[model samples]
Target: MYLQHFALTQLPFSLTPNTAFYVGLAPHQQAFEVLQTALAAGEGFIKISGEVGTGKTLLCRKLLHTAPAHWRLAYLPDPALSPMELRWALAAELGLQYSGNIDQQQLHQLLQRHLLLLAARELQVILVIDEAQALPDETLEALRLLTNLETEQRKLLQVVLFAQPELDLRLAKHQFRQLRQRISFSYRLRPMTVAEVAAYVQTRLSIAGNPQLRFSPFALNRLASGSRGIPRLVNVLAHKAMMLAYGRGQQQISWWHVRAAAKDTEDVQAEPAFIWLSAALMVVVIFGMLFWQWGPL
Candidate 1:
C-alpha cells in the first residue's frame, strides 16, 4: 500500500522470504557458508535451527537459489506426512513413476533405485525439509533411512532440515537421538543485532528501489529495539511505520511512528512501558552530556 507513496516498485517488508530482499548479514552469511561447506562435503544430515521469525525460510530459499547447478533439489515445505507419504513425496520429487496402490516396500525400492540412478549421473540429490519439527518420529526415522542410500564414497541423498528451535528440543529426546547423531553440520540462527537491524532495513529499502531513502537514525534505533532484532518483526514494524507515515503524508518515518507500529505487533508489545522508559533515559543522558559540554551558568 505504501509502495507508490514511497516511490518504490514493491513492498519492502513483506513476510515472504523474497531472496531479492535478502540481506547477507553475519548470521545469514555464516549459515550460508555452513550450508555450502556441508553440502559440498557430502554431509548426510544438515540442520539449521532458528527462533520463529528469524528468517529460517528465507535462508532456506537463499540456499536453494545458490546451490550448484549439478545438484538436484527436492523441497518439502510441509512435513506433516506419514512415513509412507514422505516416501511418496520424495519419490515424486525425484520423478519416480509409481502406481498409487503400491505399498510401502515398493515405494522404498523405487526411491532407492532413483537415488542410485541420480548418483550414477554424478548429480547430488538434496532433500530440504522445512518445518522439520512437525515431522512425526516415524517420518524422521524414515528420512534417516533414506540417507542410508549411499554410494561407497558419499551419501546419495543429503537432507537439509530447516526448523524452529523446538526442533532442537525434539532432537534432544532419546527417541530422536539416532537421527540427531547423523547431523554432520548444524547452525543456530540468531536474531539480528541492533546494528544489523539498521543495515537490514536499509538493505531492504534499497532493494525495493529506494537506495537513497532511509529511516531516520532515531527511527532505525527504535525499530531495532522494538523489533528485538528479529527480521520478521523488523519487517512488520517497518512496513506498518511506512504505511502510517504515508497516511500522514509524511516522507520520513519517525520514532513515534515506530512506537505506534510496534504497539500493534503482538510479539513486540510486551515492553511498552520499558520502551518509553528507555527513550526517556536516552533523552536525559543526551541532555546531561550536552549540558556538561556547553552549559553556562
Candidate 2:
C-alpha cells in the first residue's frame, strides 16, 4: 500500500523467500559455502537445520539456482512421504518413467538403474528436500539406503536436507543412528544479530529501489528487540512500521510505529522490561513538548 509513498520498486519486506532480496549475511554465507564444499566433495547426505524463519528454504533455492553446470538438482518442497512414495519420487526426479501400477521392488530397480546411468554420464544428481523434519522414520532410513548405491569412489545419488531444529532432535534417537551417520556435512542456521538485521533490512530496501528510507535509532532497536532477531519477524514488523509511518504522512519511522506494529503482530514476544522504560521516556518527551508549547499549562 505504501510502495508509491516509499518510491519502492517492489515491497521490500515480503514474507516470501525471494532470492532477489537475499543478503549474504555471515551465517547464511557460511551455510552456502558448506553446502557447496560438501556437494563438490560428493558427500552422501548433508543436513542444514535452523529455527523457524531462519531462511533455510531461501538458502536451498540459492543453491539450486547457482549449482554448477555438471550438477542436476531435484527439489522436494515436502518430505512427509511414505517409503514407497519416497522411492517413486526419487525415481521421478532421476528422469525414470513408469506406470502407476509398478511394484515397490520394480521401482527400486529403476531408481538404481537411473542413478548408475546418471553417474556414467558424469552428472552430479542431488535431491534437495525442504521441511525434512516431517520425514517419517522409515522414510529417513530409506533415504540412507538410497545413498548406498556407490561406484566404489563416490555416491551415485546425493541428498541435501533443509529442516527445522526438530530434525536434529529426531535424528538424535538411536533408531536413526544409521541415517545420522551418513550426514557427512551439517550446518545450523542462527538468527541474525541486531547489526545483521539492520544490514539485512537496508539490503532489502536497496533492492526494492528505495535505499533512502529512514528509521530512527529507537525505531531500529524496537524492531530488533521485538523481532528477537528472527528474519521473518523482522520483515513483518518493518513492513508494518513503514505502513504506519506512511499513514501519518511521515518520512521516517519512530519507535511508536514499531511499538504499534509489534503489538499487532502475532507470535512476537511481549515487550521486555526495557521497552517499558523506553515508552516512559517517550511519554516524558511528549509532555515536555506540550509544556513548552503552552507555557507549563
Candidate 3:
C-alpha cells in the first residue's frame, strides 16, 4: 500500500525470511562464519540459538544457500514428528524409497545404506533442524542415535540445530547431556544495536529503490527504542510508519508518524509525554511554515 506513495518498487519490511533483505550485521555474520567453519571441519553437531524473531530461519536459509557443493543438505523445518517419522523424513530427503510396510529396523538400514553411498561419493551429509526446542525428548534422543552413524575415521552425518533460547534450557537437562556434549561449535544470535537498526532501515529503504528518502533522525531513534533493537520489530515499526506517512502524502517519515505507528502496534508503546511532544513539534513546524508564508511584513 505504501509502495506507490513512497516511490518504492516493493514492500521492504516483509516478515518473510527473505535473503534479499539480509543486512549481514555483526551477529548474523559471525554466526554465518561459525556455521561455515564448523560444517567445513565436519563437526558432528552444531547448535545456534537465538531469541524469537532474531533471524534464525533466515540464517538457516543462508546456510543452505552457502553450503559447499560437497555437502548434501536435509532440512527439517518441522520437528513435531515422532522418532519413526523423523527417520522417514530423513530417508525421504536422502532420496531413499521405502514401502509403507517397512519396519523401523528396515528404515534405519535403508538410511544407513544411503548415507554410506553418499560418503563413498565423497559427499558430506548435513541435517539442519529449525525450531529444535520443540523436538520431543524421544525425537531428540533419536537424532543423537542418527549422529552416531559414522565411520571409524569421521562422522558420516553432521547435524545443525537452529532454535530459540528455550533450547538451551532444554539442553541443560541431564537426559540431553550427551547431545549437548557433541556440539563442538555453537553461536547465540543477538538483536541489532541502535546504530545497527538505523543502518538496517536505511539499507532496506535503499534496496527498495529509495536511496535519498529516509526516516528522520528522531523517527529512527524512536523506532530503534520501541523495537528494542530487534530487527523484526524494527521492520514492523518502520513499515507501519512508512504506511502512515504515505497516507498523509509525505515523503519523509517524521517522529509523529513513528510515534503513532508504535502506539498502534501491540508489542510497542510510546510514552504519553513523548506523544504530546511530537504533536507540539508538528504544531511548531506548521506555525513556522505559515509565518514564513503570510506573517506581518
Candidate 4:
C-alpha cells in the first residue's frame, strides 16, 4: 500500500524469501560461501543454524536457487514427518513411483536403487531440510542411514539442514553423537550488526527501486536498536516506519516514525515507554532499599 506513495517499485520488506532482494551482509555471505564450498566437496551432512528470525530460510532458498547443475536437490521445508513419512517424502521429491501397498523393506530398496541410478548418471543428490529441529530422533537417524548410501568415493546423498539453534542442542546429545559426527561442516548465521543493519535496509530499498528514500541516521539507529540486529525484525520495523512516514505524507523516515513503529510492533524493537518504565521501577526499588537501611528523615 505504501509502495506507490513512497515511489517504490516493490515492498522491500516482504517476508517471502526473495533471493533477488538478498543482502550479502557478512553473516549471510559467509553462510552462502560455506554452503557452496561444503556442497561442492560433497560433504555427507552440512548444517546451518540460527535464531528464529535470523534468515536461515532465506539462506536455504538462496542455496536451492544457486546450486550447480550437477546437484539434484530435494527440499523438505517441513521436518515433522516420521521416518516412514520422511522416506515417502524423499521418494516423491526424487520422482520415484511405487505401489501404494509397498512395504517398508521394498520401499527402502527402491529408494536405494534410485539413489544409485542418480549416482550412475553423475548427479550429486542433496537433501535440503529446513526447520530440521522438528525432525524426530528416528527420522534424523534415518537420514544418517541414507548418507551411508555411498559409492567407494563419495556419498550418493548429501543432506544440508537449516534449523534453529535448538537443533544444535539436540545434536549434542549422546544418542545423536553419530549423526553429529557425520556433519562435516556447520555454520551459524549471526544477526546483523548496527552498521550492517543500515546497509541491509539500504540494500533492500535499492533493490526495490528506491534508493533515494532516506532513513535518518537517528531513525536507522532506532531501527538497529529495536530489531537487535535481526533481519526479519528489521524488516518489520522498517516497513512499519515507512508506512508511518507515508501516513503523515512525509518523505524521510525520522526517529519519531521509528519509535511509533516500535511501539506498535509486538516485542520486535524496544519501546521507549517500556525502557522508561523499567528505569522508574529500578529507581523506586533503590529508594525503598535506602529507606529500609536508614530511616527517612
Model 3: per-residue Cα lDDT over 218-246, one tens digit each: 89889888887777888788888888898
Question: Between which residue pairs do clashes occur in model 4?
Answer: none
Instruction: List, residue by residue over 1-297, the lDDT tens digit for candidate 4.
Output: 898988899999998889999999899999989988998898999999999899999999998888778889999999999888998999999999998899888898999999999999999999999999999999999999989888899898999999999999999999999999999999998878889999999999999989998899989989998998888889999999999999999999998999999888886745557767998999999999999999894
Q: What lDDT does candidate 3 reach at residue 49?
A: 96
Highest TM-score model number: 2
lDDT of each residue in 185-279, candidate 1, tens digit only: 99999989889998998888898988877788888888888878999999999999998999999988998789789888888845457767998
Candidate 2 lowest-lDDT run of ten? 87-96
Q: List the residue pairs that clash in candidate 1.
A: none
Shift in Å, residue 194, candidate 4: 0.7
| Candidate 1 global lDDT | 0.90
- The deviation in Å at residue 54 for candidate 2 is 0.9
Q: After superposition, how far is residue 206 of candidate 4 from its true place, in Å?
A: 0.6
CA lDDT of each candidate?
0.90, 0.91, 0.89, 0.91
For all predicted structures, in order, the TM-scores are: 0.92, 0.93, 0.90, 0.91
Which runs of model 4 end up more than 4 angstroms from their true locations?
269-297
Ranked by TM-score, the better of candidates 1 and 4 is 1
The per-prediction CA RMSD against the true structure, in angstroms, equals: 3.3, 3.2, 4.6, 6.5
In model 2, which residue pairs have backbone atoms overlapping below 3 Å? none
Best-matching candidate per lDDT: 4
